[model samples]
Target: MIRPQWEWALDDVEGRRLSTPVTPVFTAQYDAEQWLGEHWRELAAAGAAQASLLHDGKQAAPGVELRFP
Candidate 1:
């Protein structure tokens, strides 16, 4: 059986994909979400303007805004 691939697609203010600060790939969606919850602040500070949850190279949910006050 093929396990689902979970990852985050991070974008910049201009909506361009980022190459640095590589995102982690997961076997479960829950683990991917938890990783985001813990590192969102750093991601935002790293110039990530938005984040989208992806499963097997396809969008799995609505994108998240990374702007923090």
Candidate 2:
């Protein structure tokens, strides 16, 4: 099996690692990034310490992960 281009990951409040993964809601990187910027607060308030929009289930660079509170 292969990973999707865009996927959502959730970490515990103040955690550094992703604790869970849900179905990807976006197919494009741009859309995924936009979605995170738009709905980050809601996700955080709902119990996400840090939310990430994974690109092909990987990070582009070290310390360059797209994480939001």
Candidate 3:
């Protein structure tokens, strides 16, 4: 099952939420990294989708997850 993209915090006064896609294209276990990195600049320039890097306080990868507006 696809994970939820949004989570709510108890302290959110206006019910502000934290959201991010739990499954991105790069989550595919193929050559996703190479394809995503190579085309990301053009994709972003074309306003296709929003791309952001993922990190866990240490390492970063070339994988990208796209979110739509």
Candidate 4:
């Protein structure tokens, strides 16, 4: 089995931590009340609900209304 290694001090290595442009071709938001039930485990395990929903799931509920921006 092959495995990947990450040496923070290595200069010869090409890390996957590089930044890239994110042209959002598709933008949408999920209904939390709907998704929460299905993704309860995921939501609970998420480090940050806002960050997780926006980045991971592309959902953000700022107020009573959800935004896809």
Q: List model 4 lDDT by residue over 1-69, tens digit each.
A: 532221111011122221221212222243434443454344224321222234343334331211223
Residue 65 shift from truth in candidate 3, angstroms: 7.0
lDDT of 3 by residue, 1-69 (tens): 762222111111232322422224334423444555556545544443443344322124432334334
Give RMSD to native, each candidate: 0.8, 4.3, 10.5, 15.6
Comparing candidate 1 with candidate 4, which one achieves the higher TM-score? 1
Question: Which runs in model 1 stand beyond 4 Å of their true positions?
Answer: none
Error of 3 at 6 (Å): 21
- Regarding TM-score, does 1 or 2 come out ahead? 1
Off by over 4 Å in 4: 1-31, 48-69
C-alpha lDDT values of all predictions: 0.94, 0.60, 0.36, 0.27
Candidate 2 lDDT by residue in tens digits, 13-50: 56656544343466777787777677766666666666
Distance from true position, residue 27, model 3, in Å? 11
Pairs of colliding residues, candidate 3: none
Worst 10 residues of 1 by lDDT: 13-22
Worst 10 residues of 4 by lDDT: 4-13
Q: Estimate candidate 2's alpha-carbon lDDT, on a 0 to 1 scale.
A: 0.60
Error (Å) of candidate 2 at residue 3 is 9.5
Candidate with more favorable, higher TM-score: 2 or 3: 2
